[model samples]
Target: MTALAPSPTLSETTRTTPGAGWLLRLHRPALYLWIGAVAVLAVVLLWLGGPLTDSAATAWREYDKSCDTGGSCRYDQDSIVRYKDVYAYTTAALTALPFVVAAWAGAALFGRELEHGTAQLAWTQNLSPTRWLTTKLIVPAVLVTAGTGLLVALHRVMWTAGDGRIDTADAWYANLTLHANGPTTVAFALTGLAGGALAGVLLRRTLPALTLALACVAALRFLADQLMPHLWPAVTQVTSLADGYRGSGLNVDSGLVTATGAHIADPGCGSTIVAGCKTVYADLDATGFYTTYHPESHYWPLQLTTTALVLAVAAALAVTAFVLLKRSTAAPARVRTEAAA
Candidate 1:
C-alpha cells in the first residue's frame, strides 16, 4: 500500500518560499492604485510630448508675430493656456508622488501590520522581524524606484520636445521642474520609502505614522531644494551694459559691478534716462554687470550630487529601521532571560 504524503507545514512553507506573497496580497489595493496612477500620468506625458507641444508651438509663433510686435494676433489662446495648465499639473503630480509613497508605506505597509499584531504573528510563524521589515522595505523601494524612474524619463522626453517651443514652459532651474525632470525624482521616491518605513516602525500606529511620514518626506524635499544651488559651484561672468544680463540655467545672483570691483544693485537704468538717480548711477560705476549662475552644463552635476545626498539619507534611515526592528523584537527575549536568571 502507498503511504499518503504529508502536507507541508506553515513554517516549512514560509522558509522555503522566496517572495512576500502574503504581504503583496494584503496590499494588492495599493499596487493597483500605483499602476493606475502610472498609466494616467504616462498618457498625460505622451500628450504633452506630442499634440500639446505642436499646439503650443503654433500659439507661440502666432503671438510672437503679432502680439509681441505690438499688434493684435489671432492666436489659439485656449490651446496655449490648456497646454501650460496641463504641463504644470503634470509636473506637480510627479513632484507630489513621493509623499504618496510615504503615506502608503507608513499606513499600509508597516504601520498597519505593527498596529494589529500582524507583524508579530508573522514572526511567530517562522519569519523573523528583520526579514519582515526587509521585505517591506525592499519591495516598496523597488517599486518606487521603478515607477519614479519611468516618470522621470517621460518628463525629460516631454521637456526636451517642448523646449524653446512652448512659451509657457518653465526654466530648467525652476524648483518643481528641476526635481520632477531628473534622477532627483527617483532619489526622492526612495527617500520617501525609507523614511516612511522608519517612521512607521517607530510609531507603530497607522494614522500618526502616515501623517508623520508625509511630513518627513516634505521636510526632506524642502531641505533638498534649499541645498540644491550649493551642490555645484556657480559661475560668475561680467557683461557689458550693452550685453545685459542674459546668462541662463540656474541664475544665482545678478548685480552691478562698480569700476572699483564692488557689487551694487542694478540701478534700473537700462537705456532709459532717470534724472533723480544720476548721482546713484555715477557712484554705482555700472560700466558693466556680473551674473552669478549655474550654466546649463551644471544641470546634470547638480542633479546627481543632490541624488547622492538624498540616497545617503535613505541609507541612514534604512539602517535605523533595521536597528529599531532588532531592538523591538529582542526585548521580550532579554526580559525572559532576566526573569529566568
Candidate 2:
C-alpha cells in the first residue's frame, strides 16, 4: 500500500491562501468604481475652488459695484447661478457617500458571501472566521477612510475659496457644508461601513441587510445632527430688544430675557423689529433678546466631538459583528468535532 500523504497544518494552509489579494480580485469592480468616483470628485472640487469661485466672485463684485453707483445693474448672472448649482450638487454628493458605503458593505461585501455559502467555504479553507472578518473590515475601512478624507479636504478647500467672496455661499454651520468640510464625514463613512457589516452578518440576506444598514446610517446621522450644537458650549449673546436676536452660527436657542433674569420663549415673531412682536415682548416683560449659538470658532470643536462619538459607535458595531460571527461559527465546529470523535 502507498504511504498516506500528510495533511497540511493550519498555519501552512493559511500561509498559502490568499487574503486581501483574493478579496481585491473578487471585488475589483467596486474598487474601480470607488477610485473613479474619488478622482472625478477631486477634479470637480478643484474646479469649484479655482475657476468657478473666481468667476462667481468677480460677478458678485461687478453686481455690487453697479448697485453702489445706483446704475442699471448688469453682471454675469449665469455665473452666480452656476456656482450655486455646482456647490449644492457637490455638497449633496459628499454627504451621500456614507449611505453608498453602507449599501455596498451590506449587500455585496458581507451579505452576498454569507447568504450563498461562500463565506463558509472560505472558512473551511484553513481560514478562521475571525480572520476572514478582520480582513474584510480592515481592507475596506482603509480604502473608505482614505477616499473620504481626501474628498473632505478638497471640499473644505472649495468651500473656503468661496466663503467671503460669494454672497450666497453656505455658512460654516450649514448642515451639508458642515459635514462635508470636516473629518466628521469621514467618520460617518467609516461608521456606515461597520454598521453595514454588522447588519449583513446579523441578517445574512442581501436585501434585508441593505435595508437595515441604510436605516442605521440614517438614524445615526439624524442623532448626530440633533446633538451637534450641544457638543460645544454655545456663546450666549444678549442684545436689547431693539437690537433683536443678533447672534449667528449654529443656533442652539433664542428667546426673550426678562428683567427678572428669567428666559421665556419668544413668540412666533422673530424680534422686536415687528410692531406686533414688540408689543408681545413688552407684555411678556422681556428686557432683551438672548441668542445662544455655536459661532464659527466652535466649528472644529463640534466636528471633532461628533467624529469621536460616531467612531465610538462604529467600534462597538465592529466588535459585535466579530462576536456574533464567532458564536455562529462555533456551533458547527463543535458538532463536527463530536461526530468525528
Candidate 3:
C-alpha cells in the first residue's frame, strides 16, 4: 500500500490562514496607536461637550445679562476664548484624520507588504492573494469605520451642546463643522482606505502609493464639498434689492433677479441702501435679490446623500483593487502552468 500523507493539524492550518488574528499580530503597533488616538480624541470631545460647553454657556449668559442692564461685562472671557481654542483644535484634528488614515493604509498596510514581497510569501502559503487582500480591506475597514463613527458621534454631541448657548459657536453648516459632525467623515475615511489599497495594488511602492492615495482622497473631499449643496432641492427666497441677501443655512446661490424674472449674478454690491448699489442694480434692471439655500431641515438629507455617494465610490475602488490583485497573481500562475506543461 502506498504511504498516505498526513493531513495538516489544526494549529498548522490556523497559522497558515491569513485571518484577523495574524493580521493583528503583523500590525499590532498600528492597532495600538489607533486605539490610543481614538481614546484621546473621545476624551477631548466628552470634555468639550460637558465642562467646556457648560462654562462657555454660563459665561455667555452672564455677558448677556450684563449687557441688558448696561453694566460692565463680568463674564469669564478666558473661558470663552478657551472654548473657541479647543473647538478649533478638535475640528482641525477630525478633518485631518482621513488623510492620516490614507497615508498609513498606503505606506504601511499594503504598499510595504507588496514592495517587500511579503504578500507573495503569504500567497505561497495556503493563503490566496484574493483572501489576503480581502482580509486586509475588511479588517482595517471595520476598525476605521468604528473609530471614525465614534469620533463623529462625539463631535456632534460636542457641537450640539454649545448650540444657542455659545454666541460664537460655529454654524451647523460651516464647511469643516458640517463634515466633521456627520456620517460624511466616516464615509470619507472608508473611501480613503479603499483608495489607499487601490493605490498600493497599482503602484506597489510605498512613497508613491502614499502620495497617490492622499491625492485621491483630497480630490474626493473636494468633489464631495462641491456636490453637497445640490444634493437636495434648495428653497429660494426672493427679497427686494433693499432687503439684500436674506436666507440662512447652506447657501447654494445668491444673485439678482431681473424685471424679466431672470437670475443674474450679483455685482458684489450690498443693498440699495448703499450709495452705488442702487445705481448698479438699476443699470442691470434688477428688481430683487434671489437667495437659494438649504435650511437646517435639510441637514440630514445632505449628510446622508453625501455619505452614500462616498461609500459607493469606496466600494468601486475596493472592487477594482481586488480585480487588479487577481490579474496580477494570475499571470504568475499561468506562467508556472505553462512551464509544467
Candidate 4:
C-alpha cells in the first residue's frame, strides 16, 4: 500500500505515430472530387478540340477548294481570320485555365481550414508548423504546375504555328505571349496560389474569398501586362549603325524616338544618295505598319527576358505571402477567432 506507481517508459510515452504525409492526406476528399472533374473535362476537351483543330483545318482546305497550287501559295484574308480564330480560342483556353485551376486550389487551401476551423488542432499536432504548411501547400502546387504547364505548352504550339496575334487588348494575349514559357509562368502560378491563400486567410468568408481572389487576379494581371512592361529599363528597338537606313520611318503619332541629329529634309533631292547627311526616324509601331528597323532582326530575346522580369515580380509577391504565413504570431485558433470577431 505504501509503494508508489512507476512512471510510464519512454517508448510507451512516445507511441509510434504516422509520418508527415498525414497532413497532406486531409485533402484527400477534395483531391478525389478534383480527379473526377478533371476526367470529365478531359473527355469534353478531346471532343471540342476535334472540331477546333483538326477538323477546322480540314474544312478550310476543302472549302477553299484550290489553294495557290503548282508550287505557289499565299494566305488570303479568309485564311488569316480562320487561322487567327483557332489560335485565339486556344489562347483563351490556355489563359483562362490557369486562373481556373489556381483559383480552385487557392480556394481549397484556405477555405476548408476556415470553413471547419480544423487548423486549430492541425497546428498543434506533431508535425512542425513549416512541415504542416509545406505539405498542405506543396501538394496542390505540384498539381497546379503540372496542369498549367501542360495547357501552356499546348498554347505555345498553337501560338507559334499561328505566329502569335499581337493585340494585348485581346483577352487571350497572356496565353499567346507566355509561350516563352520560362520563369514567368512559374511566378504567375505561384502568385495565383498565394493570392488565393491570402484571400482565404483575410476574408474568413467563402464568397468574399472567391470574389476577392478573382478580382485580385484580374487586377494583378492587368498590372503585370499593362503597367510593368512600360517601366524604365524596358527593351527598345534601336538601330545597329549610326547611319542606319529606315524604311517608312517615323510615325508622327508616337512622339517617342524624336530625330536626334539635324533634319536633312529633302533639300531638293529625290532618290538621290546624299553623301554626308543625317536623317531621323521614329515610330509608334501602330498596326505594325510603321516600318522602322532594329539591330535585332528577331525580338525573341527581348520578349523572353522581359517575360522573366515580369515573372520575378510575381515570385516576389508569393514570397511575401509565404513569409507572412510562416511568421504569423497568433496561434491558429486564436487568430481565427480574432479574425472572425
Candidate 5:
C-alpha cells in the first residue's frame, strides 16, 4: 500500500504564518506608546473645541466691551493668555506627531530586528525575507495611518470651530496649521514610516537608523513646505492704490507694478505721501500694486496634490527597501550554493 504523507509540524506551520499578528505582538510597546499619544492629543482637541473655546469667547467678548466702554481689559486677560498657550501647544503636538512615529519605526520596528539576530532566525524558521520586510512595513503603516487619520479629523474640527472665534487661533494658511490641518498630516505619517523602514534596512543599526530616519523626515518636510505654494496656480489681483486687494490663504507676493511694466518691491509705504514712498514710486514709475495669492478655494487641491507628492516619495523609498532586501537575501544563498559546489 502507498504510504500516507507525513503530517506537518508546529515549526513548519509557524514558519508559514501569513498574518501580521506576530509583528504586532513584537512591537506592542511601541503601539501602546502611539495609542497613548493619540489619546492625549484627542483630549487636547476636545478641550480646545469645548471648554477652551467657550472661555476664549467669553474673554474676547469681555475685552471687546471693555474697549467699547473705554475700561481696562485685564480682567479676562488671564483666560485669553491661557487659551492662546494651549492652542499653540495643540498645534505643536499635531505637527510633531509624524516625527515621533518615524522615530519609533526606525528604532523599534526594523532596526532592532536587523541589529539583533532575530531577523535571520525568523528567516531560518520559515519566513521569507520579503514577507519579513512586508510585515514590518504594513503592520506599522496600518497603525500609523489609523492613528494619524483620527487626529486629522479631530484637528479639522477644532480648526473649523476656531474660525472667527478664538482671537489667538492660527491662520488656515499658516505653515504648521496648513500641514497639521490637512490630509498631509496622515500622508506625512506614512511617509515617515516608509522613510524609517528604508533607513533601518540601509543602516541595520538601531541608533544610526533612528537618527538618519528623523533627518530624512525633516528634510522632506522642509522641501514640502517650500514647494506647497507652487503646487497649484495662484490668483493675481492688480488694482490701483485707491482700491487695494485683500484675501485669505497663502500670500505668495505683493508689490507695485510701474508704468514701464517693471515690478518693484513694496517700500513699506503706509501712504502716498510717506517720506520715501513718493520718491521710490516716482523712480520706479509706479502705477499700481498687484498681489498674488491662493484663495481659500485652493485648500483642497493644494492638500491633495501635496499628499500625492509625499505618497510618491514614500513608495519610492519602500521599493528601494524591498530591492535591497532581495539582493541581500539572494547573495547569501548564492554564497552557500558556491560553497556546496
Candidate 6:
C-alpha cells in the first residue's frame, strides 16, 4: 500500500518520459563524430591552403589572353579549375552530408516510438502525437542546421583565396548557390523531416523507417542528377565567339613561339599577350584554332536553377505525411519488447 507508486500513471508499454537527458544520451555520439570529422577536415584544408602563400601573380601568368583571328586567349586543359575548388567541390560535399544526417535523425525521431508502441503511452501523458513529433523535430533539426551552417562557413574560409584563375563552370567549378528555392541543403532537411514522419506512419518500425529515408535520398539524388535533365528541353550552351580570334597574320599578337611547339604544325604559340608572339606567328602565318566556350551568364543560372527544381521534389514526398498518418492509428499491432526493457 506504499502509496502504490503514485497510482502508476505510465503503462509499462510506454517509453521512458525521455527528459532532455534522453536526447543527449541518444544523439551525442553522432554529434561528436561529425564535429570530429569537420575538425580534421578543417585542419587538413588549412595546412594545404598555406594562409600566407601568394599565388595571384602565378595564376595571372598562367592564364589571360585576348581574341582576334583564332580566339580563346587562355589555355588551361590540365589543372583543376580554381572556381571548381571554390564552388563545385565544396558545394557537392556540403550538400551531400546533410542528406544522410537528416535521414538518420528523421528515422530515429519518428519511427522509434511508433515502432515501439510507446507512442500510445507517451501520448497519454497529456501530449498529443503532434507535440511529441514537434519536440523530436525541433531538437534534431536545430543540431543539423547549425552543423550545416558551420560547414558552409568553413568552406568559405578555406576557399576564399581562389576567386579567379578558373571559371566556375569548367571541369570543377559550378556557381551553385543557396538563394535559389529549395537548394540542396534545404531539400535535404525537408526530405529528412518528411521522411521520418512518413516512415513513422507507413512502416511503424524504426529500422524500416531509417532504411526508407536513406533509400529515398539516394534514389532522388540519382534521379535529379542523371535523369531529370533529360526530362525537359536541354539548355543549349552559349559560346563566346568574341573570346576567339588570335588575330590576323600581320597583327603579330598571336603569341606564337617558334622554338616552342613547332614541328609538323606551326608551333607559333606564345604567351597570351601580344609581346610573347612576336615574329613567330608573323613568319608562320599561324593558323588559328578556336573552340566553343560557353558564355559567363549561362554558367551560374541554368544548372543552379535546375538543381533547385530537382531538390524541390521533396515537397511531393512531404505531402504524403498527412494522408499516411491520418489513415493510421498509433495503437500497437500486438506488443513491443523494447517497452518492457
lDDT at 28 for candidate 2? Answer: 74
- Between candidates 1 and 6, name the one with more favorable TM-score: 1
lDDT of 6 by residue, 194-270 (tens): 67667766887778888887777666666555543333433222222223243211111122223343322436353
Q: lDDT tens string, model 2, 123-206? A: 887678999899889999999999999999999999999999999999999899999999989988988899888998999999
lDDT at position 92, candidate 3: 90
> How many times do residue backbones clash in model 4?
0
Question: Which portions of model 4 miss their true places by more than 4 Å?
Answer: 1-24, 29-90, 161-186, 227-307, 326-341
Question: What digit string (tens of lDDT, one per residue) describes model 3 on residues 1-341?
Answer: 66544444424544665698778777777898999999999999999999999999999999999977899968999899999999999999999899989999899999988998888878877788999899899999999999999999999999999999999999999999999999999998998899899999999999999998899789999999999999999999999987788989999998999999999998888898888888898899999999999999999999999999999999999999999999998999999899999
Considering TM-score, which of the candidate structures 1 and 2 is the better prediction for this target? 2
* Rank by lDDT (best first): 3, 2, 1, 5, 6, 4
**lDDT digits (tens) for residues 1-341 of candidate 4:** 45534433323322323233453354556566656645544443444344334444554454455553543343244544554565555545555654664566447666556556554345555544455455556677776666666555544454443332222112323434543233345446655666666666666456666666666666666665554334324223333233243432112111122344222232322111343323322231111111222222223443466556655654664565556666663565578799999
lDDT of each: 0.83, 0.89, 0.91, 0.48, 0.81, 0.50
- The true-versus-predicted C-alpha distance at residue 120 of model 6, in Å, is 3.7
TM-score of each: 0.88, 0.94, 0.94, 0.57, 0.91, 0.53
Which candidate tops lDDT?
Answer: 3
lDDT score, candidate 6, position 257: 24
Q: How close to the true structure is residue 213 of candidate 4, measured as C-alpha lDDT?
A: 64
Candidate 6, residue 188: how far the Cα is off, in Å: 2.8
List RMSD in Å for every model shown: 5.8, 6.3, 6.4, 12.0, 6.8, 13.3
For residues 261-315, what per-residue lDDT tens digits would candidate 5 score against the true structure? 7667877674464566677667778887888899889999999999999999889
Clashes of each: 0, 0, 0, 0, 0, 19
Which sections of candidate 1 miss by over 4 Å?
1-18, 66-72, 240-244, 264-273, 284-287, 337-341
Point out the worst 10-residue segment of candidate 5 by lDDT. 4-13
**lDDT of the structure predicted as candidate 3:** 0.91
Model 3 misplaced stretches (Cα beyond 4 Å) = 1-17
